[model samples]
Target: MSPVRQWHDGLQRYGLVVALVALILLLSILSPAFLTVSNLVNVLRQVAVNAILAMGMTVVIIKGGIDLSVGSLLALCGAIAAGLASAGFPVPLSMAIGLVLAVMAGGAQGLLIAYAGLPPFIVTLAGLTVFRGLTLVYTNGSPITGLPDTFLVLGAGELLGIPAPIWVMAMFFASTHFLLRWTALGRALYAIGGNEEAARLSGVPVMRVKVFAYAFSGLASGLAALVLTGRLNSAQPTAGSGFELDAIAATVVGGASLAGGRGNAWGTVLGALIIGILNNGMNLLNVSSFYQLIVKGLVILGALLFDQLVVRRK
Candidate 1:
């Protein structure tokens, strides 16, 4: 590649990092509390749920698919965990059931999309409603509380001088990073996103990979629910409403192309941080909640526009 092209490519890859730094600097200037250690840690804690969700989103989007149900799936999974916990199940066992339920839901979505050849958008859209409805029905439109102390610790506790949620986010990111950078499945995901027919012709197990991708997405959502439930010490039937948009926004803002085949775990982390920072800064500045929604919408649109530009340049 020419030097100019190389520089452009580098920009495309690291642009989100630049944006993140710039955002931090701006926030630090605008809000006196933005740079404090406590506040910064707060940012990471706040972003943890979205970051975890984005990790799975990175995989799904890379395979040219989307999962609109993740937010609702989170509510459903979280409710199950809290209910199980309240029913005297061990914390670990309850959590395991929650994760298993999420994985099963994801795998079912994958089966439909892969074997039944349903459009991911349609299938997952249906899932969004179904999961949310299930959550409400399960919880009777109420929040589940009185969770075990051990379960609350998962959300409210710290580890080795860091918040537990941050630790979980880091571990999940590291695992996903390795999966995408070093695994054959990861390469197949990219290939399928780049061109499904070509990937299939080259002996890629497209259906299997798609199934795995959706399943992974589900797993991520379930994990996120655990953290959220822990943090809140309760699981609201309406929890995670609109969370899928934030996850999708984070993935795209981190430089993942909506068209697929272009993104990474690190980028999603940065994207999530950017979002977390934006929300934090706005709250500090007393920006209206309505305006915050507007800002988030704009960010998503801007990321989509940037993705289009990158595609054109290529």
Candidate 2:
């Protein structure tokens, strides 16, 4: 590679890490409480759901696709389990049903896009609307409560002296990293994202790989739903609103190209931490929610601008 090209590549690879460290330093200085062990644990707990979703979003984006329905899907899937549990069904069985539905919902949308030639944005957008409606209708516009501790353990319970959600996120991050780094399916995803037509002509199973990508995204939503529902000890029909944006922001900020064919598990984790730290700091400093939203949007826009103006040239 040319000198400039190598420099840009290195920047793209390590920029997020640098940004995360800088953010942490800034936060720790701005708020003495930011470095406290309790505050750090709080940040970890909050990062779990978004990080898990981002991991799956990374896969779909790396495969040259986007999923706008994940937030709504989380509500629908979590409600399924929550509703069942409220009706006295076994915890595992209810969770299984919810997870299965999430996978099917995600895969069906993927199939429509891959086989029927529908645009992914349109299909998932429709899913976003449809799933939200289904969630509302299923729960009769109310939240499901009366959850058992057995079911809630996945969200609020600790394992090995660490929060369950943290462990869940760690396992997900590792598995996703391994898949993208080592598996043939991972190669197919990247190839398709880099150039779909060329990849198909090169004998890549483009459609199947795409479907798997979407389904995996669904599974992430499923897992996130369980944690979220557990944390709340109830499933809200309105839960996960705007979560899709958070996931995309993390994926984009983590060095993934909006144009596809780039991103890594570590980058996403760092991105999530940067975001978590920023939010935590903001809350500590008494920043308004309105400003926080603006800041978040600008952060995402900055990532896109950096990718387009600096990295894409190479």
Candidate 3:
């Protein structure tokens, strides 16, 4: 390849990793606390939830689909798990029921998109509202507290001196990486995302794979819920509102193609870290939440523009 072409390819392949390193360095210079151990740990813990959600979002987007209901799914599942446990059900059983509900919700949306010919966006949008409503009904618009210590440990406890949520996030990221890099199902996801019709023609189980992608996304939301609930010591029906946007933003910023068939676990993790660090640094500088939102939006827009101009350009 010519030098220019090689340069462009390198930029596309290594851009996210480079950007994350640059971001960390910039933040460290701007905020003395940015590199402190306690602040770094805080960033890790705070980012764990979004990182987990982004992993799921990465998979769904890779399959040429979007799920706008994951935030609602998180709330509903978290509420169900925390609510039942608080109401005296066995903690483990309550969590399982909540996770099952999450999978069902996602599978239902996937079926609509894959088999019923409904658009993923519309189905998930409806689910966003519907699931939130179900959560309110289940909790009577109240937070669920008094969770058992055993269940809370999943979210709030520490293991190997690291926060539980961070561990959970790491596990999910590793699993996602393994799934995309080393499995037949991973190949199928790419094929379907690259071209659904062609994949079906090639004997890929396109519909089943589609369902699996969304279901996996749902499972991620449920796992995030567990950590979030544990961290807060309660589950609120209103929790996870707008979290879908964060997950999508992180996936896109991490270099995932919105047109599908491209993304990586490391990139998504770095994206989440960048966002988390960005917010943390801004807080250290006392930037207003309003300005933070604008800056963050611009950053995502920049990433999308770069993807279109450099990564996706022929």
Candidate 4:
């Protein structure tokens, strides 16, 4: 590749990292509290939920699909888990059931999109509303409380001086990284994303892969719900509202093509960290929450523009 092409590729690949480093530096200079160890750890903890969601989104998007229901699924799963625990179910069993339900929900959507010839966007958008309604109905528009101490540990406890959420994020990211980089299933997803018809003709098991992508997304949302519920020591029916946007933004900022066939677990994590830093820094600087939303919207637009430029160059 020419130097110019290499530079463009680097921008697509390392842009999020550069942005993150620059943001950290700017924030460190602007706010003394930003560089503190406690605050840094807090940032990681805050990003963990979105990072998990974005990793799953990465898989779906790379398969030429999306999952807008992730945020709602998170709420539903958390509420279910909390409700089960409150009703005397074992913490493990409660969590297991919540995850199972989430996966089933996602798989159902995937089957529709893959086999029933439904549009992914429409299916998941409908799911977004359905799951949110289910969450509200399940919790009667209230928060479930009185969760077990062990359940709380998954979100708030520290292991080896690192927050449990961070640990969980790290483990998930590592495993996902391996899957995307070294596994045949990962390659199949990329192929499907690049060209579904071609992938199917090539015997890539396109439908199965699509289903797996959606199922993985649900699994990630379930894990995020666990951490979120634990952190709050309760599950709010309204939780995770608008969280899907953050996950999508993270995936895009991490260099994932919105059109599909691109993205990495590490990139998605970095993107989430960038978002976490932005939110934390803005809060520390007393920036208006409304303005923060505007800023995030602009970031998403910028990422898309960058993706377009790279695509045109290619």
* RMSD per model, one decimal: 1.0, 1.3, 1.1, 1.0
Structure candidate 1, residue pairs in collision: none
- Candidate 4, run of 10 with poorest lDDT: 8-17
lDDT tens readout by residue for model 1, 242-287: 9999999999999888788989999999999988899999999999
Candidate 4 per-residue lDDT, tens place, 1-314, comes to: 79988887787777777889999999999999999999999999999999999999999999989999999999999999999999999999999999999899889999999999899999999999999999988899989998889999889999999999999999999989999999999999899989989999999998899999999999999999999999999999999999999999999989898788988898899889998999999999999999999999999898898888888888
Q: Which candidate is the best by lDDT?
A: 1
How many collisions between residues are there in candidate 3? 0
Better of 1 and 3 by lDDT: 1
Model 2 gets an lDDT of: 0.92
TM-score of each: 0.98, 0.97, 0.97, 0.98
User: In model 3, what lDDT does residue 64 have?
Assistant: 94
* Lowest-sum lDDT 10-residue window in model 1: 12-21
Give the lDDT of residue 283 in candidate 1: 98
* Deviation from native of the Cα of residue 19 in model 4, angstroms: 1.3
